[model samples]
Target: MFFKIFIFLLFFIQSSYAHELRPAIANLNIYEEDNITNATLSIRLNLEAIIAEVDINHSNTKESKQSDKYESLRNMSAVELLEKFNSKIKNLQNKIYLISTNSNYNLVLLNIDIPGVGNTNVARDTIVDFDIQNIKDEDLKFFWDKNLGSIILRVNSPNNEDLYSKLIATGKKSDWFNPKNKKEVDFFDNIRSYTHLGFKHIIPKGLDHILFVLALFLLTPKIKPLLLQVSIFTLAHTITLFLGVLNLIKIPSVIVEPIIALSICFIAIENLFTENIKKTRPYIIFIFGLLHGLGFAGILNEIGISDGLFISSLISFNVGVELGQISVIFLSYVFIALLFQKRLWYRNKVTRPLSLIIASIGLYWFIQRLFF
Candidate 1:
């Protein structure tokens, strides 16, 4: 019964993890002028093609209600009400973007001069909006009057509504071919009203990401294999991250996420039975990491940062993520590696169980993500 339960758990995990992981892309662009930083912002999901889904239920309900004799025409139409609400929601969530630092904020009311859309320069006016809630500093006057060239936009949340409000401009990050100049671009970087500390989304807090990496490294416990897999994953993620951000390649979250979860479960299961990683492990990891990285990028994409200073920001953010991942690996090794040294049966009992557990958790995530 114990063995049977373990097997059942294994299948459950595989199924769940397979559907939970979504793929996204993060990209940053920095624009500079006259040595002083003019705009340094990061843009995420600038090129996401949100395929509109027709609401059949809504249509059917509206038709049925119209045919009802008892219902008054004056009565609030559910379909009409839904349509109005959805429209407002869609407008707010068109291209969600977040401004990172809202402290001592300079809410510039920018009338962007898109080359084709408007008259002249993109950063023409310098009228800043005022929000007293975020102003904690005594010297708030500096942000109000000074023409400080530096503008940093960062994403705090990655929800649909947030994306529509914060993300200023929309286009492929890599669309250098049709250089519409800065004026024709979308989101303009002007600081907003919010908290002082740097803000980011909560997606990184997911346990599946950790388990995926853990499962990948548990088998060999050797530096070489670990390094190879890590390197491949990093490289693959980088490629897709860039591509996804630029809108060069767009993969829907619904499809990409579940697959990533499945990948985690599969790796853990393989570790349970297979002793050798085989030479192709690195290659496979790279491919999957590419998908996973895109998902990570999605958070950043929702937040808009200036085109200037994007390089430094991107490098720093990527490094920060890497450091976080490495810290997890170190802690796990310290906690589990020493145990393996003491007992040979540790491989069969502890390692396998741990792998199974990881796989099970991943499976659960997959199911919840897909069905829910």
Candidate 2:
């Protein structure tokens, strides 16, 4: 039963290219065409997931009942996917809400750019454009439906650059913003929102990260060694995550992912040999942590950070990640370590087998990421 369950998990994890359902990012630009105000909206989203009506709340399409439908849509060519979208244009229209001067505007389809079915395992980026007309000189409010999930929204005006930007929650209306005026955003709100996102990124969505943390746990349940390694890991990742977001250190995911897998494999292999924390283990873990931070930066880059809220959001996200790591450690202690750490056969019966399994999975992931 355990083997079967593990195999099933591996299959789903492999299929989940993005691993998480990232919030769609919408950029709206307003301009005057012959004295008439017109706005163009370009939103980046996973069209296949939307078309299949997959429940994004569960992290990825593989977790949905409509997973098969999503796969079929995901593999469609650009033109083929456009046709599928047209079939449900009305439903799609209702998903995005735009209000100006208390008047609602219907978005007219402009164009869609869908990439070819390249690497069907990875989620494809589709840019859909729409034109919004009949804008008044009042606050514009945007709302994304619960069915459509969350969205990161940005508005730009001819007179002002980056007029407004916010991460709108599903089914919740945004704070009103006018293009002509400068406004101050709530500081605490940005912190609270991103902290939640950062936590979510690790707990349920970040499978690779979870496994890496578990590999650390399997080393030993001793508080001093465990705490020391985790602290070093956290410090190193924090440094790189900040530098990565600033574009100071820019390495593509292709290089970073394989190294991350190797790190997992290395730590698990070490566990099989060492009964306690090795003298050089902390330094090695620190290096791996730096690599993992680059991975975290990729997610932040996708979500985007407004110039005004950069520091607060970044710090909050790191805090959330730390909290997630702590949660994983706490649970492992309660369930496995507390019960088994003191057993005479603990090292031979528990840690050895688990470490081997982790090492195997890590090696498999490394090979898959490198060649496939």
Best by lDDT: 2
**Whose TM-score is greatest here?**
2
Local error of candidate 2 at residue 105 (angstroms): 1.9
TM-score for candidate 2 = 0.93
> Residues 164-205, candidate 1, lDDT per residue (tens digit)?
122212221221111013322232222221111011221234
Give the per-residue lDDT of model 2 (tens digit) for 1-372.
446655765676666645357788999888888888888999999898889988857677778999899889988999999999988877888878888765888899998899998877778889989998868778878887788888888888776477778888877877898756544678998899889888888887776788788889898999988898899889999999999999999999999999888998899899999888888999999999999999999888877777787899899999999999999999999999999999999888778777777777778788878886
Q: Could you tell me how far off, in angstroms, the CA of residue 289 lies in candidate 2 after the best superposition?
A: 0.6
In candidate 1, what residue range of length 10 has the lowest lDDT sum? 140-149
Q: Cα deviation in Å at residue 67, candidate 1?
A: 43
What's the lDDT for all of these models? 0.46, 0.85
| Predictions: Cα RMSD each | 15.1, 2.0
